[model samples]
Target: MTLLAVQVLMWIVVGAAATGFASWLAHRSYRRFLRKSRGPVSKSLGRGDVPTKLDTLIDPLEAQFPCQSGLATLLDNADAFAARALSAAQAGRSLDLMYYIWRTDVTGWLLLDALVAAADRGVRVRLLLDDVNVQGFDPAFLALTQHPQIEVRLFNPTRNRGHVVRRTFEMLLGLARFNRRMHGKLWIADGRLAIIGGRNIADTYFATLDADTRNSVDADMLLVGPKVDAVAALFDSYWNLGLSMPILALWPGFKLNRTAFRHRLARHVGSAPSRHYLARTLDSRTPEAVLAGRLHWTDKVQLLADPPDKAYGNHSAAWMSTAIADILTNAQSEVRLITPYFVPGQAGISGLTALAARGVKISLLTNALAATDMLLVYGAYRRYRGALLAAGGSIHEFSPLPKNGRKRDMLHSKVFVIDGRQAIVGSLNFDLRSAFTNTELGLLFEHPTLVADITGMIDALSAPDQAYTVSRPDHALQWTVARPGLPKLMYVEPEASKLQRAISWLVGLLPIQAYL
Candidate 1:
């Protein structure tokens, strides 16, 4: 054989060996991470325990405001923030909070301080946060876990732990595992009062809480009565399950001293900005009224939650979306949907089309291209805009922040109202991710009063000032937008820049529809 041929063969063999070794190393690392799983533990709410601390504060309030069954009050974005703070402060026994994103911003610190105070006062606090958004907030979480009464866990956490660089590499290697996420948002205080819906712990979500209108519009339900217990049960199921792991266990480098951690948190809480925000929150008198059981309640509320295994591609555990689909399918008169991301896959499109064909007045409200935070999701959703509009349904896209507001505002609400009598409010967005790859939670209310309230809110949001009507006129798509107390204007369907439209077009060409 020729010397050149032998040299070429040798180089090819060396390249193959290196590739095989690298693949093996990645697989080995993944297995090592999986081996740390501790399986499920038998933790529960410790039912029937005598409550000396909680009863002292809650019992009298319950007596003062009694409900026939479950009572639910619709809390707009700002009011919901006040309610959560109040619940944490008034808690005697426990506080359980689970959310998809708990940003380490002003709002996050304010709530964290409240929880820490509750824990310091002997109130057991359990926080279950999703692993996807915890990249930059590792120190905050590690410090939080140092408190004796506070326990922190991340649901389906990344094996790379808090490091964003390593987590990105792991995601590239483990696409399937990284794709699924925990999308539920919940807050349960004293195991007696619960708040469930779309608001996460972020400055953007609670923009109105600090009298800041520069955030997204979200909704949550303040629930009491027997339903709180059911929501607690859902929390337990995720907390004790094998998929969740303690933050300390996942990140071995988190060795901050407990005393120093507490002091640091206290110092930050006592800072000027935090103290000012706290004073304002307290001055609102909203907390006082909430603790006194002044919220209006309803009689019937059905809790819908997706199991943690939904992140493992388990379709059966996607109960929130399933229930929502069933509700739309059974609608008699009208179906109104308000969601931030609306990527109606073939099944969703068909279902809604069938509903519209049955003479049901179907209306959809979602984010416009200029207002959406996710471009790929908007790309997938825009493909169906014409089809849905052609099927005798109305589609309203939220406008970007008006020049009068502080910053750009987006529509982050997930709501469904049917027949003016039944409504759903929760964290289940009408997108493929929420339907197939994320755990979600929501409440179905059949009370006429609450449904009417939601219906009215929907009417207000659907006004021309808040959203633009997307219509296909003269064989082309156009958007009609109206500013607050101003004349209406028209534009193209996307209302996006040329480069953005080009990127969106490229994303649309990919064959990952189910995942998008």
Candidate 2:
């Protein structure tokens, strides 16, 4: 309580306030600059002026299916990568891609090379990426925007573009704006074909990494029909959003070294893993099969997408979750839900329990603690286990182990099957984030073949050896693993270490479920 001490404390408080005010002012100015310097709005080349190769290939299918969309499910990792690569190779007019994550790894490099190759063949390429994970890849993206046939944009980018610490600080300061990300994934080629699903551009996603590494078990649907025009329109909406800032405008003085970037990408092609993956991708017959009019044609395809305004805290614009809820509400026989992260709030639990009470067989599949990448989300999910089980719902947790000689570390596919009649395949996870915080996309179709194929895959993944079944028998939670010799039951989370369990328990006590 001395005068000197009080003066020192006052000065310290003043200095802190001044520093905070300066930071806030800088962030506000940066936001204003981004808004004023956004790139011009551009729309997709809906039905291109010229006849593209894709047009020649899909025109026959269009004639046969009439108003239906040609759909092919991509379950294998190699096939998913092949669909994108081969489609890009065949793209003659324009290619529009939007993703939440596009890594700078092996498969990522290969895909970028494919995009560059398509650009070389006079294909107009537009890439819109969520800026959350685009850190440390700016040089490559900058080089891409230099190409005459290519344009790159980032959604909800940070003001600080250099150091990770500064970027993190900026994100923390603008948490409200930065937290709402564009989580949808779509790839449209020539306005004739589109790939929509949960797979992002990465080595793990395509299984092009080392055998020891854990790969994502994902799914995508390749569509070659009139419905692709709708997909293109959706891409145009996101591309033209005010939040989509052109990379060139963000870094005005950054010079592009196209030769150097091309060389860097070329080196990846020669690597053993890249070469092996490229061979498999090139050998895939998916593109040819689509071109040959061999696909499941369905006229009941519906595009479920959240508007770009969702990123601006517009929860009313979130229609994907609402549509999915309606599907769940109308379920007649059975429901199958699959996602990597599953943190169903009280409302989801209540709705699901109500469905179960109506004799609807509810089966849920999600990543086990060891198989999941997000430990905190897994912890949040654990809180709802008992309620779901009490409602007579069966929960299957995917294990991070090799299933039938294939290694899968996580279940990255988000799917929902209703009454064995209709299915949804897309990036919308059944979580609070997907429901309220982030934008998502999906295809709701009633094709018997596609629905059966998806349900079959779900059945395979839910088998005893591949996943662990959780039960609350005798008022205690236990995990049952149906091994070859005998069934094993454990009280704690399967395959998770003691420290991990402790951390998850601690995380569950936090009030951060809204962000999960």
Q: Give me the candidate number with maximum TM-score.
A: 2
Candidate 1 residue runs with Cα over 4 Å from true position: 1-42, 47-69, 162-165, 208-214, 286-288, 291-294, 400-405, 484-491
lDDT of 1 by residue, 1-516 (tens): 999999999999998897667657876776666556543363435535667444565566567656633445545555667788877877777889999999877768889989999998988889999888886788889889878888898887777754668777767666777778888999988887788888989878865334444578788888767677789889998887666788887767668887876787778777776777667656666544655454555566789888777766666824778878887888998999999888878899999999999999889999887788888888788677787888889988886545454666788989999888888999988888788888899998887777877778777777876778888766567777665554355555445687777777777677666686
| Model 2 TM-score (2 dp) | 0.93
Please estimate how well model 1 matches the true structure, expressed as its whole-model Cα lDDT.
0.77
lDDT of 2 by residue, 299-375 (tens): 88989999888888876734789989988999999999999998878888889999999999998999988788899
TM-scores for all candidates: the values are: 0.88, 0.93
Candidate 2 regions off by >4 Å?
A: 1-27, 284-286, 290-294, 403-408, 484-487
Give the range where candidate 1 is weakest over 10 consecutive residues by summed lDDT. 38-47
> What's the true lDDT of residue 94 in model 2?
94
TM-score (C-alpha, index-matched) for candidate 1: 0.88
